[model samples]
Target chain A: MLQTLPTEAALADAPPKPILQLVGVRKTFGSFAAVENIDLDVREGEFLTIVGPSGSGKTTLLRMLAGMDTPSEGNITLHGELINDVPPNKRPTCLVFQSLALFPHKSVGENIAFPLKVKGVDAAARKARALELMRIVRLPESYHDKNVMKCSGGERQRVALARALAYDPEVLFFDEPLSAIDYKLKKTLEKELKDLHRETGKTFIYITHSLEEAMVMSDRIGVMRAGRLVQVGTPEEIYGAPVDRFVCEFVGEVNTIRVKRGPDGLWSGVDVPGSFKVAPPQDGAALDEAFVVVRPEFMRFLGPGESADNRLEGTVYNEYSLGSRIQYQVRVEAKGGEKVMLVELSRARALPPGADPHVTLGWDAADAFTLES
Target chain B: MAITHKRRDAAIWGWTLFVLVVVYLPIACGALASFNKSRYFGFPVKQYSTDWWGKTVDSIEIGMIVKTSISVALLVTVFSVVIATFGALAFARYDWKGRRLYQKLILLPIFFPQPVLGLAMLLGFNAVGIQTSWMTAVFAHMVWIVPVVTLVIAIQVYGFDPSLEEAAFDLGCSRLQVLREVTLPLLWPGIWSGMLFAFLLSWSNFPLSLYTTGADSTIPEWLYAKMVAGYTPMVPALGTMATLGAAALLLAGGLVGMLVRRRATA
Candidate 1:
C-alpha cells in the first residue's frame, strides 16, 4: 500500500502546467482562411516558436494569441478558463511587434515603463521597474533618458524587449522581432533570448520564419505551412525526424530522392534511378510512394574502395566553396535522363584540384529518412 | 550641354533669396508706412512719427476688432484641430469601405476659392435662417481651415507605425489611453503645425469674415473697410501689428520646438 510514494522534489519536477491553450482555432477573412485548426497547449514556462515562411499564417496566429484578433472559430483558454472574447489589454499577455513599435517620442525609460504606467503605477515605481528591466535586457542605465528614436536598431530592439518585460505577463509573444536584424546580431539576440527565458521562467510564444532561430531558443517548434500547422515537436525531433517532405525541406536544403516501394519491400528510385537503402518512417507506417531525405552534411564522396549502405556514380558537375564546407554538384542518371545530386564535404575532405571529375556519392541508411508524399 | 553643378547651385540660391525678398517687400512697406506721419504712403517718407501707432493702440473699436479676430482664430484653431485629428486618422490610418471617397470629399473645401466657399456658406446660413455674427465667421474659417489641418496631420499619421498603438493596447492600455499616450504624442508636431496654420489663416482671413460677420467685425475686415473709406495711417499701422503678431507666434513656436528637440536628445 505504501509502495512507490513520490517525494516533494518529484512533485516539483512534474510536467509544466498548460498556461495558454487553443483548441480548434481558426481565423478567416471573407472566404480566405488565414489560420485554421490550431490546437496548441503552451506550457507555463516553455519557449515555443511557431515558424513558417512569409504568408504562412504564423503572424495571424500570433495576433490571435496576443488578442489583437479573435479566432473566427474555436476556443482560446487561459488556465483552463475560456477567454475567447477578451481584448488584449484585459489579457495578461503582451506582444513584441515585428517593427518593435517603440514610442518614438518617448525616452527609453518611458517606453519601457509604458505598461506599468498604463496600470496607474506612480512615476517612481515605474522608473525603478523600468531600470530593472533595462538591466535585465542589458541596456545601459544612462540610456534611461535617451529617446528611443535616437537609439540604434539593436538598442531599440532591447528597448522593445524591456517594454514587453515590464508587463511581466504570463506569456510573451514575439512577432519575428529578430527578422530584420543582421545575421551576427540575430545570432547574439537569439542566445540572449534563451537566457532571458531561463531567467524569467515565463512562457514565451515566438513566431519567426527562420528555423535556425527557432532551433536556438525554442523548447518546442511548430512549423506552419500556408494556413495550417504542419508539424509541432522539439527542435531535435523537427530537425532529425521531420514528418514529411515539406517539413524536411522547410528546415533546410536536403537531397530528396523520389521512390516507389517495390514488391520486395525495397525502395526503387523513380527520379534518381537506383535501389537505395532507406530508414523506416518515423511513425513506422507502410508506404507505396515516398521520398528519401538526406541532409547535405550527412552526404559524402566515396573513395575508390569505400562503401556505404547507398551509393550512386556520377561526374562532378561543379564545386561550391561554403567557407567551412565544400559542396559538390554530382550529375546522376535517373529515369528522366540526368539529374543533379549534392554531396557535401568538410574543407579538409575536398577533392584535390586535379582529381578526376568522375565521383561516387554515398550515405549510410541511418542518415537518410523516408517520408510519405 | 547640361548646366554645370556650380552654376546650378548658384542659380538655386539666387532664386531662393529673390523669392524671400519679394515675399517680405509688402511687410517692409507696411512697417515703413506705419511710421509715416502723413495719411498717404510714399516710397520715401517726408516725415516719420509714432502718432498712428498711438492712435491705433488706444482706439476701443480697434481693440474690440483685435479681440474678435483673436477669438475667431482661437475658436477655429481648437475646433479644426479636434475635428482634423480624427479626420486625419480616418483619412490615412484606417482601411475601410469608401475611405478613398471620404478622403476626396473632406479635401474638396481646400480646392474651391475661399471667396466662393464663403459665398456658398453664407447662402447656406441664410437658407438655414441662422443669425450672422463673429461665431459664424468661426464656422466659415473652419470650412476652409479644417481640410488644410487634416492634410498636415494626415501626413504625420501616414508616417506613424500603427503597431505602436497596438503595442500599447497589448501592454494593457485602453483605446483612449493608446490615443493619449501614443497617437497624440507621436502626432504632436503635425498637430502643432496644423494649429499654427489654422490660427494664422483665420486671423488673416478677409473674404470669409466679410460675408459671414454681418453685425460683428474682425481685424482684417475692419482693416479692409478703413483702407477704402477713412484711409487713415491706422490701416497700415494695424496691418504692421497683425504681421508682427504672426511673426511673434512663429518665433515662439520655433523656440519651443528647438527646446523640445534639445530636451529629447538630452
Candidate 2:
C-alpha cells in the first residue's frame, strides 16, 4: 500500500479539516441541467463517494469537482480558495478515468512518471519515483519497464492509480474506474482501493453507479436523482433512513404498501382490509395516506404462537433459495386487489413446499418506515 | 474429414489464384511488353533487349517528369498528413458546434469531379494572381488529397478511446500536450497510411496535373504529352516502372496500417 504522510493514525491524533467544497454548483447544457444545486464538503483524508444510476449526474458532478467541466452556477473552492475558474492542470487534483486510461504507447514506469515529468522532474528521479509509486500500488517492480498495453486490465488499473498518485494531489477523484473490470477482479480491487484510500489519507471523491460499491468503500455516500442530490450520508444511513419513496426504492429491494389512518388511533390503508395498528405518525408526516416501507429481511414468516405488531395473512405464491435464506412472495388480499408481500426467513425455519400455502408475514412498526406518498 | 478439408482448402486457393490473375493480368502484360524483344508492344522474343528501359531512364524530359512527380507526391503527403492530423484531432477530441458542418465540408473534395476541382483550383489561383506552376499543381493535389487524408484518419481518430486523452489530462497534461504525447503517438499510423493514400493519388494523378502542371510536367502529364506526338514503345517501360512503384507504395501503406493496428491492440 502507498502511504502518504498523514494517515489514519495521524488523522486520529488530529482530525483533518475540509479540503474542498462545492457550494451550490450547477452544470447545464442549454436548457438541460446535468447537475443542479450541488453543495458538498470533502474532508481531508476522507473517502467520500457519490453514487447513482446512469444519467443521475454523478459523473457530471465529479467532472466539475475535477475542473474538467465548469459549473454553470455557483462556486467550487479548494482549501478556502475559489477554484471554479481554474483549469484541471492548474488545480492540485487528479482524476482516474473509467477506462483505466493507461498510456498505451508508454511503459508502465513512463506512464507513472508522466506527472513528475510535466512538473520538470529529471529522468533519473522520475524513474525512481515511478518505481516507488508502482510499489505503493502493489505492482511488482519488474512491471516498471513493461509496456502498459501488455499488462492485463487489473494491472492497467493499478498503473492508473500509480500515475494519479504520482502527482501527489491534495485530493484524487475516481470516475467509476472499476466499472469495466471483470467481477472477480472488481471485488478484489474494491478492497484494495479502500485500503489504498486509508493508506494514502488523501481526500478521495469517487463516483459510481453501484450502491453496493459505495457502501463497501466510502466513509459517506451521496445519492443523486434527476440532477439533484436527494440525500447525503453514510451508506448505512442512506440504506436505513431514506426520506422519499424514490430513495427508498433506489437503495435496495423493499416491500411497500399504501396505508391510511383510521379513527381508532391506528393506521390502516388500502393494503390492509380489516382493522390494523400502525406506528405513531412520524414527524411532519400526514395523518393519513402514507406508505409503509418494509425491507425484505424485516418481513419474517411467523410461527403459530409468535406474532408481531403488524401482520398480514397471505399465501406463499413464489419461493426461491438464497444461500442460507429463502425468500417467499406471499400474496394477500387487500382493499382493491391482491397485494404481493415479500417474506424472508432462514432456510432452516422455512416450511417445505406445498406445506405452507397460507402463511402470515409480520414486522415491527419500527422496522416499517412510513413515508408520505 | 481431413481429405474433405484439404479439397476445400485447395478450392479456396484456386479461387484466390483466379482473383489474383484477374487483377494483375493487365499489369503483367504491360510489364512483359517493357522487355519485348520486338520494337512494338508484344511479348514474343524477337530480340530480348534492355534498350527501352535504359532509354526510359536516361531521357531528361522523363527524368524531370519523374522528379516532379516525386516532389509533388512527397509535398502532398507531408501537407495532407499535417492538415488531416490536426483536423482529425479537432474532430475527435472536442465536441463543439459546427463539427458536423466541418466534417461535411472536409468530405466535399472526395465526391467532387476531378476536372471540376482542377478548374476550380485553376480559376481560384488565377483570380488570386498565382500562376499554373508546380506550386499550383502541388496546391491542387493537396486540395484533393486533404479530404482523403482527413476521411481515413478521422475514422481512426473516432475509433480511438477518448478516455486516453482524459487519462493524459489527469496526468497533468494540457490540451496540446495531450495531443502531442498521447493523441499523436496513437494517431501516427492513421496519419502515415493517409499520407500514403495522398502520395499515391498525387503521384499518378493525370486530370488535375494536366490542368495545373507547368511546361515541365509530372510523369503522367509527360506520358500524356508524349502520346499526343505519336505512339512510342518506351511508354510500356515507363508504365512498367509506374505499375511496380504503385504496387510498392500501396504495399508499404498496407504494412504500416497493419503495424499500427497491431501496436494499438497490443
Best by TM-score: 1
Shift of residue A199 alpha carbon in model 2, Å: 0.7
User: Quality of candidate 2's docking, in CAPRI categories?
Assistant: medium
Best by DockQ: 1
Q: How well is candidate 1 docked (DockQ)?
A: 0.82
* Top candidate, metric lDDT: 1
DockQ of 2: 0.56
Encode model 2's per-residue lDDT on A299-370: one tens digit a residue.
887789998988888888798898899888888887677988777888888887568588777888777777
iRMS per model, in Å, is 1.0, 2.4
Clashing pairs in 2: A260-A269
Model 2 ranges off by over 4 Å: A1-16, A274-288, A352-354, B1-19, B252-266
- Looking at every candidate separately, what fraction of the true A–B Cα contacts under 8 Å does it contain? 0.94, 0.68
Per-residue C-alpha lDDT of model 2 across residues B200-262, encoded as one tens digit per residue:
999888889888876658888777776787556677789879878988989977887788677
Runs of candidate 1 exceeding 4 Å displacement: A1-16, A281-285, B1-10
